[model samples]
Target: MEKLQLQLFLNIIGIGSASGLLFKENSLFLISDNSTYLYEYQIEKASLEKHALVENPAENILKKDKLDFESIALKGNNVIILGSGSTKKRNQRISYDLKTKKIENKDFSVVYERFKKEASLSDDELNIEGLIITADKSYFFQRGNAGNSANGIFILNADDSLVFKKIILPKINDVEATFTDAILVDTTIYFLAAVENTASTYLDGEILGSFLGRIKVENFELENTILISKINKFEGITLFKESDKEIEFLLCEDNDTEELKSEIYKLTINQ
Candidate 1:
């Protein structure tokens, strides 16, 4: 496989970790950590720029004093944000509508609750990190860290029903694999996974490195997993298509030196 070079786009500090990204109707939305605010960017002249910032209305309804926004998914004008706490309890999923700016808690809690019961596991074990809505309105989620296994993926039907479950095991390697972000383009699924030492005594076995992977949707099998760049800390992954024969990837890195001062890189695939 040929290694692709990553191009830097924009670096904003203290903006928060970009957990999720979506492009719809010519608008781009990025979800972060500190606040449930969706940063909007416009695609103009083959580039992106700040368009607006909208607060997630569902946050206002949360009775809990503190909440950490983990992942987000967009449906029509509604946005779903999932989060977990330090207590290791069941995570919370909140929904906010962009049209009315209304908040709805427990929008799809019943589905998740049923899945939890069927799996016979507590909420903490789910560790949902990435969420994606299909063309038919079905929901798919990726598990975060702290799970018993490295593979974590689930599906929620259009009726808000739990349909399938599968653990996406990583390719055998010396490093540990943890999925970070995912995006679906046409029939292809592209995801980012961070590979690191599973036994880091200094950082308590936390992931310290990352790689980008691509797979076809037909079989849901990994095609190629490549180490794109040596980043300080990687958070989110987004795809940009240049043309039929050309494509690029945008990866976000979280570095402490600059709060939101993250790095965005453009990458190409070897055909």
Candidate 2:
């Protein structure tokens, strides 16, 4: 496979880079797995501001470290944030409004329990990292680790009831791979997965690099793949069509360090 290079267009400092990334007009929201605050990155001013989670009774739901939110997706004003499929902390989701800045708590425990039983995944091993919701409320989730070299992608179709589907990823570089985030651009689904040599179960370790897979949404089959070797474990991905000839991407990384200095980068994908 030919490695795709990340053209470092710009790097932003601070903001306590965490798991998910979502853009709303001129503002970009980044969330930390270890914190309750949602960071708003002002593109025009190039500054970041934090917003507290006001979930009424469970006001600090996101503040607790167990939530382990790993992915964020937007369908109009409904910003859906999902936690990593930790069996101990499974089935947690938040729906936040971009315009009104309102938040609602949601549960999919029934589906999750069925998923665990069907997939035979252990309580602490459900490691979901990627989430994408279509306009009609169809859900697409990417599992970070599914074993050694193989991983799985899950889909929850909308019909008032849920229909489940799982797809496996082919081994990349003959090693284990895990996904962090995903997005759907038109008819295509693009996800960023990494092969990090971590020592802990869900903790970030010595990252060896990453892979970006391009799949078609209609057939839900892998169409193309790009090996991104220079960047660390990219925890989130969002696309922007800057022009007819090129596409722009914003990726955020989690260093898993004490200081929480998350890095941001701009990748220009030539169309």
Candidate 3:
């Protein structure tokens, strides 16, 4: 397959590192690392304009919080922020009111604690990166790179209760090709995998590549995995629906450089 050229979107400097994107009502919401703020961007006259939706106070939240801020999903008027920490470990699925901007702590904290305990995850293994919410279910995928544990994908019921469901692991040639980010389109699940070249154990090795794969919802089985691009450190992937025929996917890299760089790729998937 031919490589699709990605367009440069808003490169907001000093935004830490962005990890996820959500498109709602013609606006894009972003979540980033160590940020107490949620960003919203709207497209006006073919240009992207940004605004701060909410600025979380550090005193109210936990300290030593990594705030991976991996993905965002909407349920009714509530926006769910999924992330994890390193030391003083916590994997939170925080819910915030979109209109009121009120943070719901009680139920959200309970659900988050339950998931953390049920997953039996340690601080090093708790890299909660992607989330997807459906009409009756909430799905979360974690990358387990620090240990020999395989990456996990979890499902929660409509009432925010845990449901035990097993996801079929991909049989990629490389073991590090674990799931990173995900999106659900109709009945298909599209996921991103960041594969690294572990052959050389000396210097800092190059990022092998990234791939986009899809699995049918009806079967919930792994299907074809295609090489999307061979970029440097691809971290997040989100799908934006333009119309019935055209769809655009945004991919981001978590580079801690002076300029916060990311690329938006528009593609027309053959249905």
Candidate 4:
């Protein structure tokens, strides 16, 4: 694939750090890494609505106490949000029922522990940034931004077991790129990756660049990589629309701040 054509699609301000994105029907569902609320944006009306994930909604959750929801995926009528699992506090998985507008929370500590054991990852090295669910399996992407850890994809089987695969991602501008988010399109996995200078998951670093890449779901082999932006740290991506000639993707940026301003971009790829 050649360089992707990028455009400034939406400049959403006063929202938390946008980490996960999903689109269904006419609404855009987004989740922040530090907030306990899900944002629902109407495409036609350009209006934003906030639904509290917890009974009590707060504008911001402290970093130490935040659930750190990092990825969102759709399963039937449910929108599932997953935490990064870099810390014990970030081990909560949530499912939002679209039909009934109900919230269900699950403790993901056991699965996260399985990930660490299977991948040989330490506590500080495990950061799950992406999730993709199929009819019988779930793929959890582990970001390799932390200390000496390699990026990985953990496949969860129907038997409540995990099969881990270490991934080797290409470097961007001489900086190491790690997984951010991904969505499965047909048999291809389209993913977003970003480069940061920090070696610790808890610390923020300089955002060198971000890119869009593809991997074959059957063999887990990389196929293509395209530069999206050199400045924005995109942490989430979803299909906005598609046709025979072009595929449009919606990307949400994460600046790692409490300033309540974030940007989402539209990327067009010509087939």
Candidate 5:
């Protein structure tokens, strides 16, 4: 595996900490964990436009304590934003209408606990930080993590039910690795995982390194693994095809203590 380099795109301010990214139509959206609004990236002007999470997000969509929106997905004009399952906030999700610019309140809290039990995880271990819609649009893949075989994917059926799919990742240097974010290209599922220096809870771990793995949808097997980069903390991943075997990625990171600044990196993964 060849080491990939992250090119600095631009320094974004007021993001606090970016957790999810999505490219839909001609616009790109980056979600924040500390706020209820999304940073919409304007590719043509190379600028950002802030869009509020929902109508009166202050009262309905986000919590009064913290907004941990960690995943973003799109279907037509509807944009899905998911909360990281670190606490009770895991069940907070939204389907915002782009055309109407309004939020559709949908509760997953009822299923979050059941979803955790299915993954054989408790509330603290239910680290669902990534999400992607399936190819047939029948279900959504909810990425979960912990260690050993505890980390896997969850199927969010259209009827709002859940299914847990187990994934076994070979330990890196005898240390366990956990799942983060995921994206699907055709029938292949590309999931990003990291092995941290310490076993932190579902909140945020100190990332020593990260890996990109490919799993076939037919068998749900991890057929390959590739070392990507050594960023301290990798939170989200979104990709675009460049060539036959190469895909460009925009990896988001959070360094809380360092000047309170954060970055979004552009890189390419050659499969």
Candidate 6:
């Protein structure tokens, strides 16, 4: 593994609890777990746009009533936003059409139930925090912060079928790290994992650290893992740029605060 360098890139104001990130063209799309709006940031102009994804009675939804949108994936002109699926109320899926600028909401409870059954997971053991969509398959990451410490992934097919794969993630500071977000780049899958000392998926814990790692898509095996930051609870990641020498990634932090500002970091990995 080569050396990695990380730096503070930008502080995005007005967005809190940013859980998922997607970078397309010159704009960056972000979704907060507690907010009903999807944020778009113009890279060149440094401007921000808020697109309401759902009608909320309150400006920020309460923790138990929030959608808990934890994963964001792009397919064609459509952006898929998924909830953590840690609770019944969090099983809603939201999709935004870039071309149409329309929002569609679907109840993913049945799909989440299928996931729990496929993995033989308990109700608290099926927290999905990351998603990766390919040409024909979609991968969902199940964060193992809740029950059984069962970190896994679900592969969804075009025919609405699923295959479950159990993954063993490395521990940070003797605490097991759970998947927070992931992005597919070429043949490898880059992921962001964080260590929070919480036994329940619905509850917040002590933020120990975060890790940047990669896994082989062919075999679903971990290739490398590196400690990125010991303080920031990074929950979302997207590919910023790639070249022959190095690859840059933009990551959003969910500091677990009421502050309306979120920090985005640039991580460069040498090839």
Give the per-residue lDDT digits (tens) of candidate 5, residues 1-50.
25555678667665656777877655668886766777787666767777
| Candidate 4 residue spans exceeding 4 A from truth | none
Displacement of the residue 206 alpha carbon in candidate 3, Å:
4.8
- lDDT tens digits by residue: candidate 6, 153-263: 899999888999888888866789999999999999999999998889989999889999899999999898898988889999999999999999999998788788988
What TM value does model 1 have? 0.73
Stretch of 10 with least lDDT, candidate 3:
197-206
Clashes of 4: 0
User: Where is the poorest 10-residue window by lDDT in model 5?
Assistant: 55-64
Which candidate, 3 or 6, would have the higher TM-score against the true structure? 6
Model 4, CA-based lDDT: 0.88
Every candidate's lDDT: 0.55, 0.66, 0.60, 0.88, 0.67, 0.89
Residue 92 lDDT (model 6):
82
Which ranges in model 1 have alpha carbons more than 4 Å from their true place?
Answer: 1-3, 24-28, 41-66, 84-90, 95-109, 118-120, 137-139, 159-161, 171-173, 196-206, 256-258
Residue 85 error, candidate 1, Å: 7.9
Q: How big is the positional error of residue 213 in model 2, measured in Å on the Cα after superposition?
A: 1.3
TM-score of each: 0.73, 0.85, 0.76, 0.97, 0.84, 0.97
Candidate 1 residue-wise lDDT at 121: 43
Q: What's model 3's TM-score?
A: 0.76
lDDT of 2 by residue, 122-237 (tens): 66557777788875656546464534312565666565545445565545445456667888877787888777765234555566777777778877777776767544778888
Indicate the residue-level lDDT of 241 in model 6.
95
Instruction: Rank candidates, TM-score, best first.
Output: 6, 4, 2, 5, 3, 1
Shift of residue 144 alpha carbon in model 2, Å: 4.5
Among the numbered candidates, top lDDT falls to 6
Question: Ranking by lDDT, best first?
Answer: 6, 4, 5, 2, 3, 1
Q: Which wins on lDDT, candidate 3 or candidate 5? A: 5
